[model samples]
Target: MTGHTAFGWRTFLLRWSGEWADSLPHDEARDPDDEAARRARWLGFPPASQERVTAMEERLGRRMPPSYRSFLLVTDGWRHAGGFVWLLAGTADARRHDNESELADMYEEDLDEDAGPEEWREAGIWRRGLQLDVRSDATYVLLDPEDVDEDGEWAVYTWASWRADAPKRYTDFGSFMEAMYREFHSLRAHRTGREPAFVNDTTRELDARVDEARRDALRGDWERALKTLDEAEEYGRPRARGLGDQIRRLLGRTHLVYFPDVVTDPRYAPELLPPLAAEHAAHSYRGDASLTFPLRGADDALVSQVFATLEQVRAGAYRYTAPGPFGEAVDRARELARWGDTDQAWRTLTDALPLWRPLGPDHLVPLGWVADPVLGPLLTVERGRELLSTPRGGHPGEAPAPTPGLDPPGLAWLVDPGPGGGRGPYRFVLVEGVEPEDLPARLGDEDAEGAALDAPRTLREARWHLPRGPRESSSYEDRPVMAVGRAGAGWSFAFDGDPAPFAPRRFVSPAASAAAGTRAVVVWSDLGARRGESFFHLSVARDGTREYAFTCTDGEIRRTGDIPRALDPDRFFAVPGAGAAAERPLLEAVAEHFGVRLPRHALLNGRLHTVTTRSWTRPPRDGETYLVWSMA
Candidate 1:
């Protein structure tokens, strides 16, 4: 196992003749015709005589490693080992390569210069390494003289000229040759229409073992099955390698990397790809070219087709699409995830998954990416109910007309620790006639927006301005930091300043005054430690007037103007014995009464348009604490 693979390579190479390598995936730059011609001559030259090996060893004044010696005894040289390397030299050509010194220097230069002279001295290079291949296309195979093992085996390297990078290293010549053997099968695995190949008796046994392992996996004996597959991979068994990876994917040990044949193989993919893609996208860097998959989660026609195929095999996974961009729900997911509310975060994604669309008509990637790393850990099974439910997708309807003073039922989750969504202290004004996109400019995002226009952010990452606890009171923190974005038809302007949003409290009037035409509904809830410990402020403002307002601070209540018919002072203050003891139920009634809704996902998760309005002069009587939450 150390010198070369513990297998009969002589017999294996014998069967790798004629059109055997035809199934291998071709390098894009190479000619298919030329590749086929080269592959037709897969077998190596005849075995070298012992005397010839001895003479070559004496010329180099070194004893050849056991693996290379055995390889030459089997065949003097070989042609076309893997995707690269057209030839492997025999003893007849075994000598110091002409450009060995230059190649070694370049390889050494690729190392870290910051390591200093002591570390740099042991660069582990081969200035005159024995070259082992010929006619190679910018790819060299060399053996390092200084990198020998206890078994007298010299380390081998496969380097290329085009890439100014480090070479791929191997333990010995046999290990390198075995890598080529494995690469052959890996390249061929990309194609279809060919049955599995069996090269020798050992390969036949490997095929049998892999088949047994698959059966064991289906029987829920995955541990044993995985062990068998792992053993088979040591011999470069392709079936075992793929099956092991797929099994690990199911066991949550790895990702599939990409979609395989779901229809033909049809086991691990259909049941999991959608959720897995979201999970993958959630964990990976946003907008990375490698992670870019078509955002087709909303394409009902194609999604239905895929779900139907999965259904035939009894696989069940939901596809999610939001009323608008999936990023809204994704934002909510990140927010909830940061709060350690994983189950709700997951629900946020799945509930918003019903409608998705492909980037193009011919999009083939099974699932689109979610594109948010903050939401990565937001996955879990909720007592199996989440898995048991029927999956649902579809587009959002037209935004409902803004209903001032009404809190949509969804807002109840903000204070509840239950499965319902939860959030920190929030202050907002829900208003109509204010464009969601326009809020950015109104909120002083002109600078941020201008910067954004110059260089847009990644698709998956949303902005969060939450700053908890006592910290720096810098001027940046001195000014208000609010995220304004669309909430259904209306716009929600939420503040994330130190502790709270408004400093003198009357500042809420100017914010609501910014609304055009109709009056704005302003709401603020004090940060709470327990369920009913909230100090809430509910106000209706029109052009600088705090018309019809109710305030509950430190258990005291105040009301001004003609209270709207929607008023319910008892619910806003909370009544423990009234069964409306919890802040969540009371808030639910408050929201229901006002009939206005804000997408909490956008406020907490989305990187909405933020701004710092002109600061107001604090009248001395405004309060001793006029220096409270103020944005720059």
Candidate 2:
């Protein structure tokens, strides 16, 4: 009751509320019953009388061990000792595993040379063991009478046929039951979002603090919860570190923590495992079993699988992912690895990591493997240093050095910046029959009182100069700082804008129409913020007529003109009552449809030849009042 691993029958199972009504089967839940099945649902039955315990001991030809005998004194039998083992045998029903001839080969077969002295893992283990569970799932619990300790406590072994691991050995039945209690908590947290909050009455202070910390985490007060749980964990409180792990995930702060259970979610395993494996391998090399315990039962089956996966990945034979930046990069990485250029392979993965995005809530996007297929085998151990050594995602890193010689990914960065800071409320144009250098002169035509382009600036510098007026205050109100570049076969003409009353009628239509001039195809996205603002519009013009136009308001796309056959707005923007959250996939689909990509170095990182478009500002079009402020 006092030690961390203490085992108390009702004390632990009391967490389940001791509500026989709730635990009963549906047929019994409503009708009261004394049926054996119903009695079993109590998770503990009535304590065996002294005469019954003595009779069972005599029948078994040996006295029951003290730990198990004491357990029966508290409760004759127990249920759900482990996740799978459902019905634990009481004194009257307990049977011998040695009596089952079908298990002789399995139990009597040769033990591997390195097999531990744990009785449950050796040849003829079952011959000396008393089976303690009946009618179970995949797990079998055995008490080895031959393995009694000085205190007359029977050694317990729990073998889960579902896992490849050997029967896990516990020094005593009490310790084995305690491990089952811990596993139960893990299952609860994974399935139910960790309900009930408090753990128990014994560690009320720590339990209450952990519960309050969990609440804080639920309220997005992650920093507070993390700090509180960190303190609680120092007391070796149950679930304190586990809850902290969940918070660390929410904050993108899982840098230091590592253990067998380090990767909280399977999706994280791909991104996090490489670094973890690197540390594990390092510890293995140094013979420092501190970081990594000797693979006690069956070779840390999880880690062995991870290395096997890494081997497959390095050999270019892992299962392929969906077509995207990450898949392509992985292909290149594997090729490099195959060619014995592991360093370059690592750099390739790191470079593409910026573009990686998690497939869904299941993944910590951009920080996760893009469209990650599995947990193990995403990265090689040698390459983990590049990923872990480089601090990622929390802050806006300095712009990447210029890569002018390389062609950029077009304009896709406007849609998704991976795990980086938000990139949105975008206003940009795609024009056919134009060059990156020509966008300045074309955009200048849209100037109300003859606009002048500002000297080219980097994205960081350019964002600084937006929401300002020219020295001649009347010259411009919203000077657009833009990175003009080539996108695929057309020219990507993008402009920066502070939030606005989305162009009420079509400020960009005129620009699109003028820029169209009976020859070129121009597409303009005059978008609204994902939150608050409701205005959103996309237009495509060609040969002096609007080819397609649509506005996203009221959770639907209202269109004008014949929509292009190649694009589907409904597929992207048609989330009913989804609010602003629906807009993200819409923009992403647009980028995907056009194969629009922009280089990270140019659009996100280092300086590029960026020009401030001649005032994208227009006056109160369609009776819209724009909110304008200035640092100018």
Candidate 3:
């Protein structure tokens, strides 16, 4: 069998009045539009028609492709030497070829062996020769050589012949042509009652699901639309080139109703998503999809990944750039601030001037009219100066001394594991100048009434003082301290010197007291309200367990003491001389000297506590208050 017969003869046939070129019919020179000058030509046909030409499945039944039926309407029959029919099955316009050899390359079989009028007619086969045509039209018809007038008529046509056995089922031109082509096989199927197969399976199922998704999306049934698409995805991987675009579009909005949990589950392989993230960054789209479609795992992931990369770029974290700004600063601050020129040390600070200048003490941005949040205090020039000078070479002086209290019973800052130092939950306190013996009494309950700003007189006399400590000690702190008995993140400390803001109820217990020697009397008031009327009190025991006393007074202070001079101002500290009144005596000293007497005292005894030392008590699982004190 000839190559054409082997594949199946489905050819386009075009006819015109002209001498044939070379051996092939349509290769002859001819006027493209001159009705008389054009020669007949053959075009290509759909694969199903090849079955008929080869007669491979005549018994089982086979169908032609719809493309074949569409091609027959314009096919031109071949007129070759010794009745050798040249097969054709494509449009002169649709198929671009400089010669008949190109057109013949598309022809698939020998049809003359079985080409009877009924067989040809029933199958809607036409004999059309391929030819050069000036018509730029994308569509044209197939021609039957018998239907053509030999007198010469100019016409460009589909090369493939058609053997239509049934009437068209569709009216729309495209649909009609497809339906007409479908008839060629449908007839065989009807008579033989068999299924027909074609090579290169088309994804009609996927297309239907995609179309359904589109319709549902149009109807605002986003969930349903996504579900339909999801179902389609399950059928098989989408092979269409458009699948990538569809995935990206859906991803942008998928967060709204799409099963994100499922979509993001690692089980869903990243390869499952379109590779468009790299391409779509530049591809143009006209609608909201252009802006809304996700680039990577939904746009946010893309953005985060990009920013993370930018962070590396900023500090040259990967050693890509000359140690970036922050890196340079850190290195220079260490190297030069040591034994390097003090002037150069100042100059190093000067070098960082640009970055430091813009920041204000708040570490916010500078503004012309208003403060820039980015250049606020603690970040500004003066502040930077203070910070830079405070710990040059990580020490207080030149020659770089080891961190104090950090090594060999060294001195350390109020924060343990100092700046940028430790993995934390870091907790520490600074109580400079306070004697250890006097600590218990000062924390004890003595002069509780004095702890309050006003003595109880009338309902209107109620006034209170807010506790004071480091304002920087917020719930979230870069440097946190583990206090002996303080609640939440608060800390407990004893000062070696006089405490700032002498009204000592701030950090010290109002009723605590101490003696020059002997035992120290300690008492404290912890108050809090939960839900409603669930008043609470926390007391520091000599062993440091916070004992919680509930149902305490809301407006009064309580006091108790064992050491006589525990609360005596003359013992540990003397009352300020009239001239030293500006010193503002500390209230804790008075509270330790005097005894407290109120329901608030009862409230002080009940609370929760976390043990910072072995002497401290175990923390209760559920409690209203806590207290801790050192018996030593």
Tell me, by TM-score, which candidate is best: 1
TM-score of 1: 0.47
What TM-score fits each model?
0.47, 0.35, 0.17
Winning candidate number (lDDT): 2
lDDT of 1 by residue, 1-632 (tens): 33342246575666554434444344534565456544655557778899999999999889888889888887888877776787778998878864654764664766775777634533545555789877677788888777889998988977877777667889988878877866655554444454444355456777789777765544435567779988777656655655565455433455543432221232323333444444443465554333324222234554454444333222112333223555587667655543224445666665554433323211211132222333433322231222112122222223222212112334575664423434445665565567544544333433232212111111122223333444333322323444444443344444442233434344434444555555567666754622344566677767545577776655666778887554656554554333224456656665676554554443344333444433322334533542444333
* Alpha-carbon lDDT, every model: 0.52, 0.54, 0.27
Across 190-270, the per-residue lDDT of candidate 3 in tens digits comes to 232222222112235455666665444333344455566664444332322133223333333222222222223232212
| RMSD to true structure for each model, in Å | 14.5, 22.6, 28.2
Poorest lDDT segment (10 consecutive residues) of candidate 2: 368-377
For candidate 1, give the lDDT: 0.52
lDDT of 2 by residue, 1-632 (tens): 33322156556555432432233344533323235434444567778888889999999999988777877876788766656776788987797887353454775455566667753345555676899878688667888888778988888877766778766889987777767765554454344332344334434666788777755544435557678878666545656765565445324344554522335345445554443444444345544344334222324655565565445443323444434787698778654432223344456766765555544232222333311222122343323323433322332233233222322343444545445455556566666667666666666535422234344344566566544465333322455566565554454555443333354443445345435553233334433345455556677766566777777765666788876554556665555755455555655565676666444433443233455555445655465545543343
Q: What local lDDT does model 2 show for residue 567?
A: 59
